[model samples]
Target chain A: SQQGEEDPQALSIQEGENATMNCSYKTSINNLQWYRQNSGRGLVHLILIRSNEREKHSGRLRVTLDTSKKSSSLLITASRAADTASYFCATLLRDATNKLIFGTGTLLAVQP
Target chain B: SAVISQKPSRDICQRGTSLTIQCQVDSQVTMMFWYRQQPGQSLTLIATANQGSEATYESGFVIDKFPISRPNLTFSTLTVSNMSPEDSSIYLCSVGAGKTEAFFGQGTRLTVV
Candidate 1:
């Protein structure tokens, strides 16, 4: 089962603008990672924020995690037409095994 | 990070037929998993295939419906049986090693009619 819910289930933005998506989970986690899927196929990993970390950045992608609220957010700055894709947040639970539970995605459409 | 090679990227199959998707990793991995993603939906894990052991299935998933095989640490296969329109989805294979997060492969896009 999916453990997180991401909203603004759909969003539209002009190229060069910023796109922000929020994700919330219901359980404790060891780490939170964000991924981008193109055309519903292979997923490209963007960034991973450990439980102890509050925020992380990779180029234009910024991810923040709030353990107290069990929530996280991804901020993509200067979005491009190529950046248009379904973004998902996946969680690595605090359990002993290494299973990743995914969240309902946010579809971001960047108009060129 | 280990690299994965998955084949049969996309297929259109008839109802009641089955399709087997293969994933081969460049390096040995301890845990390999299978996931299903419906159009415009999140991914749901189906099972964990551990080398030298029987695959462990998650709730709402069973071996008869989605059988998995892990012949070695670097190779695994997932078979979607008795395909239906409802089974049309992207099936992904993932691998995890050490302390890193699980990495995914280019999913197999299945379409059943």
Candidate 2:
């Protein structure tokens, strides 16, 4: 079963625009991580935010986590055509096994 | 970070047949898990492969349909039994240490006809 739900199933934008994706979870989590997957390829780890942390930044990617509301958001700034991919948020629940549960994912298309 | 590899990146099989996907990690890990993702769908965890013990399955999944084997900490296998068209999906293997993020394999794209 999926623990996280991401909004905006698909997004299309011109290059240099920003893209933001949100994820909401049903249970308490130890940590939340974001991933990007190109077509027909394995997922690439983007950033991970622990429950104790409110926000984190990596290169052009920014992630924010709110434990109280059980939600997280990933923001990509100055997006490029190469940044086009499916973004997913995975949650590691505190009560469940150590397995990571992923969301439906948001597909972003950056037109050059 | 651990490097994970899966065999037969993609394959097409007939119905009622079985396909065994292999997952190998570069380093020994304590936890290994299998996940299924249908086209345009979210990932669904199939089971957790524990070395020296039976794999633990998630709800809506059974060992009979998806038999998993963890012969060692560095290697595991998942077999989709009696596959059908509905079984067509990408299967991924992941490994993690404790509460940290997991490393995933490239995934095996299976098409059952």
Candidate 3:
């Protein structure tokens, strides 16, 4: 079963703009990670934020996690045409099995 | 981080046929997972494949329909049996790395006719 739901199922913007996607979950999680998939192919790992941390950044990507609300958000600053892809947020439950429950996903289209 | 090599990147099969997807990891891992993504949809986990044990399937998925084999820590296979057009989707294999991050293989795009 899917644990999280991402809003703004689809978004369109020109190059150099910023895109923000939100994800809300149902249960407590140990950590949250974001992944990007291009053209329905393989997924590339983006960033991971642990429950102990509220925010993290890597280059143009920023992820914020709020344990109290069981939500997380991904901010992509200075988006490019190459940034057009499907973004997913997956959560790792604080359990023995390291299974990840994925979010619905947000599709971003960056026009050059 | 573990690198995975999945065979048969894409295939077109007829109804009632079966397709087995393979996932091989560079390093031995404790847990591996299989997921299915329908057209323009989110990923749904099919099962958790653990080495030396029978795979544990999720709700709405059965072993008879989607059988999984974890022969070793680094190799696993998922077979879609008695496949129909509804079984057509992107199937991906993943392994959990340190800090609970997942590494995925290039998905297999199955198209059933």
lDDT of all predictions? 0.91, 0.91, 0.93
* Candidate of highest TM-score: 3
Grade the docking of candidate 2.
Answer: medium
Could you give candidate 1's per-residue lDDT for residues B45-77 as a string of tens digits? 999899999999999999999999999999999
Query: Which ranking of candidates, highest TM-score first?
Result: 3, 2, 1
Better DockQ candidate (1, 2): 2
Best by lDDT: 3
The fraction of reference A/B contacts recovered in model 1 reads: 0.60
Best by DockQ: 3
lDDT of each residue in A32-105, candidate 1, tens digit only: 98989988888888888999999998999899999999999999999999999999999998887788999999
* DockQ of prediction 2: 0.68
Whichever of 1 and 2 has more lDDT, that candidate is 1
lDDT of 2 by residue, A35-81 (tens): 88898568888888999999999999999999999999999999999
The sequence of per-residue lDDT tens digits that candidate 3 reaches over residues B1-113 is 88999989999999999999999999999899999999999899999999998999999999999999998899999999999999989999999844857999999999999
Q: Between candidates 1 and 3, name the one with more favorable lDDT.
A: 3
Clashes per candidate, residues 3 or more apart or on different chains? 0, 0, 0
Residues B60-81 of candidate 2 have per-residue lDDT tens digits of 9999999999999899999999
The ten-residue window of minimal lDDT in model 2 chain B covers B95-104
List the candidate 2 regions with Cα displacement exceeding 4 Å. Answer: none
lDDT (Cα, tens digit) per residue for candidate 3, span A1-112: 8998998899999999999999999987888999999999989999999999999999999999999999999999999999999999999888877888899999999999
